[model samples]
Target: MKFFRLIICLSIICGVGSSTYAQKNFAKEADHAFFNESYFSAIEAYKKADVKAKPAEKARINYQIGECYRLMVDPAQAETFYAKAIKLKYASTNPDVLFRMADVLKQQGNYKEAQDYYEQFLSKKPGVAEAEAGLESCKKAQVWKAEPTKHIVQNEIQLNTESYDYAPAWGDKKHETLIFSSSRPGSTGDGIDDRTGESYMDLWITTRDNKGKWGEPQILPETINTEDNEGGAYMNRKGDALYFTRCPREKKTNIGCDIFYSEPQGRSWKEATKIVLKPEGADSLSCGHPTLDRKEDYMIFASDLPGGQGGKDLWITEWDKSEKKWGTPKNLGPKINTSGDEMFPHLTDEGVLYFSSNGHVGMGGLDIFRAEETGEMQWGNVENLRYPINSSEHDYGIIFEKNSDDKRGFFTSSRPEGKGRDDLYSFNLPEIKFILEVYVKNKETQEPLAGVEITLVGSDGSQVVKTTDEEGKFIYDENGSDRYIKKETSYNIEVSKDEFLGAKSKFSTVGEENSKKYIEELFMQPASKDVVIDFPEVQYAYDKHELLVDDRINSEDSLDYLYQTLVDNPTIVIELQAHTDCRGSDKYNKALSQRRAQSCVDYLISKGIPADRMVPAGYGETTPRAPGLECETIENMATNEEKEVAHQKNRRTQFRVLSFDYKPSGSGGE
Candidate 1:
């Protein structure tokens, strides 16, 4: 009877224990599947284990199921299981669970509540860098300023869905065709994600019609798109060269997510090539999100290779045209890079840089920040792109729209009500403020002259407006204001008055200080008497006394001076004479000189000079200082240069007060 009983016990133990062993194996398999990022397989395995696992083990299995749902983007079910796990007090008390909770709250737009949980998690696990960052970001969100409602306007290019349609770059200023990355359907490949069973990300193209309307987005050519993820593209100004990022299946090859380039041939992009810039043995870690300076001589990008401060950092590389390669990459240093990731760089035409960083205080996960490119490869202090522009979620990929009418821009965000993880947004910048001032004054007294009409001229020679304010101030909109004072532009400012001399001042806006303020003084000197104008000795070609147009007196100052002198010396009779150099025939010289002298007399007569009082004569070469010494050969003279100088000295014009004494014929002759 004892032998029978012992055999029965052994049989029972073997049967029951075998069943338990099988269940344990199944549980182990489920946990392993989850750890390997096999979310679908892990979900099935965890479901099978949930029914037979112990209370504590059941809670852990349920949490794993929630993680799988989270990874698969089934946030609703993920939150359900997470809540169950928390209630069961399974190790769901960990910071990871709180982080997921905060993510769910953020998705629901309960930023205030999400921020509290994020802070709690950080307080519990102060050493977790990512958690600490998230906590600080949450606190920032509470005080962050939203963009003012009245100043911003939604642009016309609405995305198909709120999915991440951002990182927009154009090959040219026209912005007719655009290339961006999207995880939307109809990709080049239909492969399932090992993690989420979703289609892999790929590049897409969308073109704008002649009317400026965007067409449906299409996947990139198979040559550029693969089963792997392709993103962050930028094309050269000419649209001939393409640069983008490609992350293959393997991540350990140092070439993980490296930059690639291709050239356009007609309608297609040629075979893509990897850009190799690292030395031998050094890992070619991520080099992506490239931005070319206007000249294309340099590029700024982000990388996580060795020698960086920590995590990923912004870097710059000079393009060597002769070598057809990029030089060694230089780290952007602390100003741009932080202990956290700094990526997705966008530079405006004016050299303002926009990037995303979690290191700086922001509303939430990786806020968009802007910094001026203060130096060559150096950036100024980073400023957080405040409020609604950023939120308690990741915001980045800020880009200025090409040829936008409103000075608008585009950016990406993961805020709620978006189609998916991220969505594109369009916004117009605030209007820039400027002032224009003009100061007018009497030229002689330097006193501010009022009632003088001042007209500001535009580049097209059209008058922009007239200034009549008491202070002589005028304000113009940005479009018309820049034309008034921009370099390479000429403005015709005309100041006129009844009694004051009407004067026109030509000014170049180029290099003029910011105010666009122009100050000009006009002199209204008392109009004076008729006068004989004296011109400096002007030399002419040998035996040629024809007065060139330029050689004649036409300046207003000279005319005015002549008029004044005539009015002051009323009774004076003047003689106008001409002389020539001692190189030509006396008769030829005499004739030429007489003609020149007559030309001056004729001009004075036209200016109301009495022809009789102004006598004209020519002395020819006979009036040389050293009488009878004439220069024969240029070489025979002491120094050819001296001979030429002496010859020029002989050419001159002289005026004499022939007689200052005169009697008025109207009364009596004396």
Candidate 2:
């Protein structure tokens, strides 16, 4: 069986498989085992059925075999059978073959082909949020794999076998011993799990020696590791109490899994007892993957019981000290749960929750996710650990370093790179370095401008200043031991020089997964007092003062340069002067020009620029440039096009600094 199903305690309806009849005994048995969730046995039965089946029945058998492998989490074999079933066109009864094929492909990081398959599935069934989410996950998976986080992951080959060895938990506060679940050769169970075709899982222990190498594996005593399936294990803060999932093997029975707690006593554990998370006689609903907080006041586990959003959800129940029982189980809410299975919950002592889910957008079958507590018993901000930590395979049951500041730990994965089917791995995030390299250039000449002051203001309320070198470059890597640029913060950059108009830009490190070097080149317009700067094709309506705003031209947005100038150079004040062509009356032109200048000031004020710093000056057509191109001597111009060009130039808008000493109130700048 797939680990996702097993983690939920091998849950399936007990007798549903027995009720189905088929034309062939093998076919009937295969269908029976499948509905019972015995995927491993179902695969063999279906293959046997395929030998004597007709064309249509053989196609259906192939599809059934694909379903068996898919549920067993064998994506490679599942894809093989699914591809065969698709070619056989058994799609009428198994409409999900395309989707399942895409899912398995995506689980193996074959994103491009998986995308094509997901699109094909969507073509047949439109608006399926799951398929759309899968498509989106494929897009993000490629990028995430290419630029993974600083977390380094290494397979624990010493503790692994060719079988499934995963779900490791730290057994001691010193982080030396490990208590994990495995289905290797030394398992107590004599019979194979019909679900997984492997030995029943058992809780195993291994300790670290002085050299830090894990010692040989040893099974827990009969008090914990029963002949039946034993699943994930976690320890309490004191390391005395151990909680693990146990699924008692019963022939054709729906004895769903439950969590059991055992306390260390000498060489053995006190008689293990089940933690009752379900209602009276709800044996069909599985409850496992138990985790607890530091105080052990409450326990969170995965369950498929009713009242969940869908499938398995993470549920919490506090310890009622007075009643000596767990309080009524409460769902962790839809934010942490989804319509798909959510399993293998692990909680840090500091209350950070980690779990695996296929319902949430992920790279593959099961991706590890993290959520933070928003309030008392509330959780939000569900984030994916992404890429190396969560691959295109099943990744679940992560244990931290009893962590707060420490971000390294052990987790489980069924990725192809592992030594076993599902292997334990260690992970740690290296120091993430962020370097910001800025170059200042002259806007008019495109030449590097040295001696430009670069002021960086961070969202954390940190301000730092640096000047450009002879190469017009300023590097902001760190301030002594502290990095100037940090994760999840935004920074505003102000570039200024004595003879240049101040320029402003912004850079944010939010959601950046990898260490990177950010290069920014801010061009400064040379301006002392009277320098003309052109706008980006600002268009205005005839006569009226309101600026034109459209797809092609935005007059107000064109004034943002002046807005930034005032913002970056807070001590400077400037005049926003407007002009009119010589065609209009001098009085009318003057009035219109004055209104246009005020309109610019009004727009700047809306952008949080102080009105006092910008003065409106209307020159009208009184001061036209050049002697020959003037309308007063119109005959001097060669053509009407030439004359109109000069007229358009005369009707322009520009700004000039009035004073560099006009500081705003409560400000200190020179």
Candidate 3:
């Protein structure tokens, strides 16, 4: 439900009056008030008439009361009356009650039940676009509220009241002064509005202090606030020109609301002028919720004028420099307008248009949607801002905290969590957090290795060096202060210990939109050349030198560890050695082992590693992984399985560091 920014003059088809109470004084008065848009007065009259009326009369009266509340932006009470009328079988006479009930239910965020009611209405009257759109909205809104955006929404308690208060806009370029509409107790308008039962809305202002605290609210001067509906104001980027809505006190007529313009004079604004928008003789058409583009070359406003998509459509009018007035209004087309009401259009300085609509597929009621101007006036990618920025109620009239920072702002919402029927809520998008926890451990011992030097290098040309603590844990994050890992960036994590070979892995935030915590467990091997690191899984095809590549496994991939090791420790040269079982002659086995080692060296060379960085070596089966488990000893064993195990351990692919200095050809240093 919405209040100030809501389109109140949209065509509403009232339920048929009961023949039993058609001539009665209470029922007659209620009908007259309802037809004249005095919904608050009509509801009171309808309730009194319902007290003594028959069941059929009572059903219609209750339904009418529900309609009043719905228009007045009170979904809870509207739902109550609509459910009562439906229980009395009013829906059987008028199936539109189902649609009305669904609307109110959705506004309350009971999306599943609302969809059911919408489907029921659709079955009764197939192909109703409004009902179809509502049904789709129910389903879509459920997902939006379930996985809302990063925006954190909180009711601006200092600026809200139990009465209607909404549609906040920045009153100053600095964004320190906030101007919003409130129908609280101290509004300048006197007496109750027969339409809303609250004092006619007035613009109010509150200033945020230098300490970033918002001060108490104060109403605008009398020049702007009249004994009429006045709210939903927007200021140009210059902050000098003010555009606001004004619904004059015509309780029983559809004379229509209009937009007004005012200029600031010292602490107060000058007398406002009614901005003539509609065509001549279209005085019955209502137009309000005025907003201007950043350049002030164009104005977008909500209106029920002709040539729109439907209900109330957002229209744009270009400023005519020659005529010193705005040109004829042009509809924003189906891309922006829909068959349902679209109101409260606000265009940011960045050409992003934000508005609220019941038309587009939404979470519920009036959901906030944004569109970017693609061409001269064409727009695309009309996306919902999503919940909690958009709840299952009337949410509209959004304004950012400043032109530069879009993620923080104030907007209107009639969702139940607010302090009023429609309250102003401050919203902000929290920064996405990226953290990397590096746990260094010894490869041979599998124990935590402390005091290891950790170097994090980012592709964004940022690097940070941190040492592992006594726990062998280095928490590498922004730490809520200094950020090294950032969006659209890749980082290399290098861990080096005094006696261990450096280990490196890649961690990136690129293509990742959500906050993430990386738990990287790095194992560093002892750097001594005697510590032979074996690749047992990497085997050859039964005496052939080529690396194995088959469906079961690709042994070539296992060598990537050595490939990365050579790349990480660029200055180190490695001896890629291969061994064999003593099944063949010593000379033949040595030649075969040499080819196998060269095959691995060739594979690394194809992956961009320099060939000179590796030296291939083949050792005939002279060494055994198990100290004395030689082939002759394996032959003495009783079981044939024991001999094969000894032979398999002898056949292996292993490597060792040759030197720690490997200068490139162009380097002069040796």
Query: All models: lDDT?
Result: 0.63, 0.83, 0.83
List model 3 lDDT by residue over 1-670, tens digit each.
Answer: 2253245463222223333354567988898777766687788789889989999999999999998888877888999999999999998999999999999999888999999999999989999989998998888887777777788899888778898888888888888998888888887867776666677678999998898788999999988988776887888778899998887744234467788899999978999998888999977787888888878999998999999998899999899999988888999999999888899888887788999898898877788899988898667789989888888888888988764368888888888877877888888888888888999998899889999999999898988999998888988666456676788999999987654779888978999978999999999887677778775467788878888899987888889978878887888888898989989899988999999999999999999999999999999687776776787788897888988888888888899887777898898985
Q: Candidate 2 or 3, higher TM-score?
A: 3
Could you tell me the lDDT of residue 168 within candidate 1?
Answer: 60
Local lDDT at 649 for model 2: 76
Off by over 4 Å in 3: 1-6, 10-24, 250-254, 403-405, 445-474, 479-482, 488-491, 496-499, 529-568, 573-658, 664-666
Task: Output the TM-score of candidate 2.
Answer: 0.66
Tell me each candidate's TM-score. 0.56, 0.66, 0.83
Off by more than 4 A, model 2: 2-4, 12-24, 402-406, 433-670
Query: lDDT of candidate 2 vs native?
Result: 0.83
In candidate 1, residue 264 scores what lDDT? Answer: 78
Estimate, for each residue in 406-508, the C-alpha lDDT of model 2 and write its tens digit. Answer: 4788888889988978899998888778999999999998999999889999998999999999999989887797899999889999888886778878999
